[model samples]
Target: MRIAITRRGYITELDGVNKFIFNLAEGLNQLGCEVHIISHALGGSQVSNIASYAEKFFDFQGKFQIHALPFSYTNDALALPLWFLNGSRLINKLEVDAVIINGIVPLNSRKVKIAVNHGIFTGSFLNTNRITQHIYLQFAKHIYLYGIDLTVCVSSKLKEELGKLLNIKSIVIPLPLKLNLYRTEPLGKRSPLVLHVGGRSSKNAEISIQSMKILNEKYDLDVKLIIVGHKNAYLESLSAKYKYMVPKTLEFYFDASSLVVRDLMANAKALILPSRYEAFSYVVLEALASGLPVVVSSAIPSELVKDGFNGFRLLQYDPNLYAKRIKALLTDDDMWDGMSKNALKTARKYSHIKVAKLYLHAIQDIMRMKLNS
Candidate 1:
């Protein structure tokens, strides 16, 4: 079947949604579906300063072709006029069986559009600054349900919120994974290293550091913490302070590649994610696939990790609690081995091949329904 998947903009500027779009397109292509990915001409954010975009680098490796049209820059004045003129013209011409939009957005397209909502990021912007968030929301609310045929939510948490925002029901689909790429040889003996997967506000990096500090001072645990991704001055100061207290106990990797993440996870004792809020985390799933037990918030979707089985799930940001959980795995070899084995089993369910087939079925089902009506 010929399928067209639409995304907001350029993939060079990375985020959770961009990565998901590429992975889905690749998975669909591998399954022998003719897939086409259409993206906006002008992309990026005003705050992040990712204003520049290129037509290339977001490669599908001969599986599909990327099409660029001026359907984005949603927060700007030119977006509506461009949509009514250029964007609408481009989308109406696509000769595809189904069109799936990658986010909870509406395009001025004639084709039956399926929207997949990733998160309430626009709503979350209020926590930082209200004025800019208010301005962005004004534009976003207009196109949320326009031309949408079906809506897909990635997690239960997101699905519930989408109902409140759009006042519409949506189907829930867990994030897909290319599990085979990350499968590696098990470590004979893992180092006492706990890996931190994110550095953003929602990632709760501050509390992660606090937890490690408690482990060091209170429990006298000689465990090393590996932080992967972005870090600000506050995180840097904390890391420096922790190192002064306990040398070589903390390490930070800035903007690491997939290979670096794999290498880190392979040797690490556990994957620690203390995110305050989330829709779904690909890192948590990937860590489990790499055979590392996770220490994360209970707020994280239960399907991703089961408490005490594949990882520890607790609500408290209490450093002592996190430290105690990490200590158990470090001190007990058998317990660690069992949890590691279970983690792999949990990850196996999210294999990309299975998810791609589901996508095919879902689109076909929706198309069939639309025709019947």
Candidate 2:
């Protein structure tokens, strides 16, 4: 089968969506499918040759073709309409069996078009004014279901919201993880280091820092926190500001390579994710695969992290609660060991190979239905 995947610029970035596309393509390729990446042309090295750039940054060693759109735009808003037009033209000409669009690009295609909803943008914008949120939701709903055969939501939370708010039906398929890339070190060998994967607003980075402050200062625990994500000016400033209070307890790694993140997960004692809203977190899954217990918010799907099993699931984004959990994982060796073992076991179920097969099944089922109709 021939498959085409679409995404906007910055394909080489080590973000969640980009990584998922690469991993899924690799998995499909291993399963003997011809995978083609349909993407827009962005600046920098990725514009010239995305395959080489992905290989260098994401360590993507897969067999696939990279088809770039002619024009490049730094602003996604300015680029999207053209992306839909050109992306549709490219996919229609290629005549692939299935077209997997990362987000709602509204590409005009007759193939089995699948739009993967990472999360509800309006849901994330709840903190904003009501008028703004309503406008965003209306605009999102209009474009989200256009010319798409199926909507793939990464978590049940997202799927439930899609059905409830936009009345769009979607399937629940969690993101894929490359299990082999993460090494599960023994709990005894790991340091008292806590890893937080995202620095975005929904990630609740401010609360993470506050919790780290409570851990290092209030509890006087000898632990360190590492925040990893793409470069954000706000996060850079926040890190600098928190240095005075938390001192050596917090560190930020902006635009770190995939290898560096894997290494950190391997050695960290626990992963803290106090998200305000989450569709699905690849970081939480990756941390579990690394044999690291996680302390996540209730916003995270229950399927991924079971409270007191693989990790603690807090109902609120309270710093005191997060600090309490981090303290236990860092100081209580026995509790940490048990949860760490369970974390590894939990990760086995969501391997990239299994996820790829699920995606393949979805694509095949949709195509079969189309043929019958």
Candidate 3:
């Protein structure tokens, strides 16, 4: 079967969404589907110097073909419309059997469109304000999905949220992660440390920092927090005085080359994600594959975490509670080892090949339905 997937364009950098698309395309390709990735960008060598507006074809790792449209405009609004125009043209030209839209707002396809919803943003889409963006999203419930034949969500929570918008249910298909590259190994001992990734307001990193601070102050705990993609000014000052125990990482797209982050997960005792809300955590899955226990808030969905199984869920959003649980993992041997084994077992369901099979089944069903219709 021939398949086409569309997503937002980026050149040398990959956010979570881009990485998800790559994994999906690779998975589909492995299933004997001729997969095509349609994206929008302006950087690579153009069709010609005068034709900065034409599409360019390139091979991505000899796995899938990338059809990138030349989008030159810097204005956010203008770029999207141009992206929509060129993306439609490419998908239509390819004559694919089925097309998957990576997210609600990425691109449009003329083929049998299966709209994949990551999550509806109560926050900003691009540079737009909250009020206007809300209205746009509300309108998008109808306007943006006019041609969609089906809708899929990455999580049940996201499906429920988007169903409230579209007034129709969608299937749940969790996102894929490369599992082989994230192998687990026997650990002699783990460092008394925690990892907090992403700095977005939704990430609620401040609360994670607060938990770390409480541990450092009152509990006489000697644990460290590895802050990635964000830094608090006060924590920076404190860590400086304390000899750089707590460290922050620059926000960059590591693509499949997240060796440093993976190393941290291997050595660290636990991964911390105290977000108020999240669709699904890629890092939590990655950490679990590395046999790293997690400390998260009660707000995180329990499908990915259990209160006392692979990881503990904070019954309340208390910093002291989080700190206490983290300290237990760091200090105890039996509890940590048990949870680490459970974490690895839980990660099996989310492996790349398993997730790929789910995607293949869905795509095949959609193609069969389209043909019958």
- Computed on alpha carbons, the lDDT of every model, listed in order, comes to 0.71, 0.83, 0.68
Model 1, backbone clash pairs (residues 3+ apart or across chains), number = 0
Q: State TM-scores per candidate.
A: 0.85, 0.91, 0.83
Q: Which 10-residue window of candidate 3 scores lowest in summed lDDT? A: 50-59
> Clashing pairs in model 1?
none
lDDT tens digits by residue: candidate 3, 1-373: 7888776545323346665676676667677789877765555354222121211111123266667677754555566677667777777789897787764444566466777776665344645777877766765676445667778877787777777766766788777766766656555666667887665666666667778877877788777777665344544443455453334321122122366677778888888888776677777878888998899876566777887899998867778888889888877878988999999888877755566687667767777887797
On the 0 to 100 scale, the lDDT of residue 122 in model 3 is 33
lDDT of 1 at 196: 92
Residue ranges of candidate 3 with Cα displaced over 4 Å: 9-13, 42-62, 72-76, 105-110, 125-131, 143-145, 230-257
**TM-score of predicted structure 2:** 0.91
Q: Stretches of candidate 1 above 4 Å error? A: 41-62, 71-84, 121-124, 127-146, 184-187, 231-247
How well is each residue in 172-216 modelled by candidate 2, as lDDT tens digits? Answer: 887887788889888778877888888676788888888988887
Q: How accurate is candidate 2 locally (lDDT)?
A: 0.83
Best by lDDT: 2
User: Can you give the lDDT of residue 340 in candidate 1?
Assistant: 90
User: What overall lDDT, based on C-alpha atoms, would model 3 receive against the true structure?
Assistant: 0.68
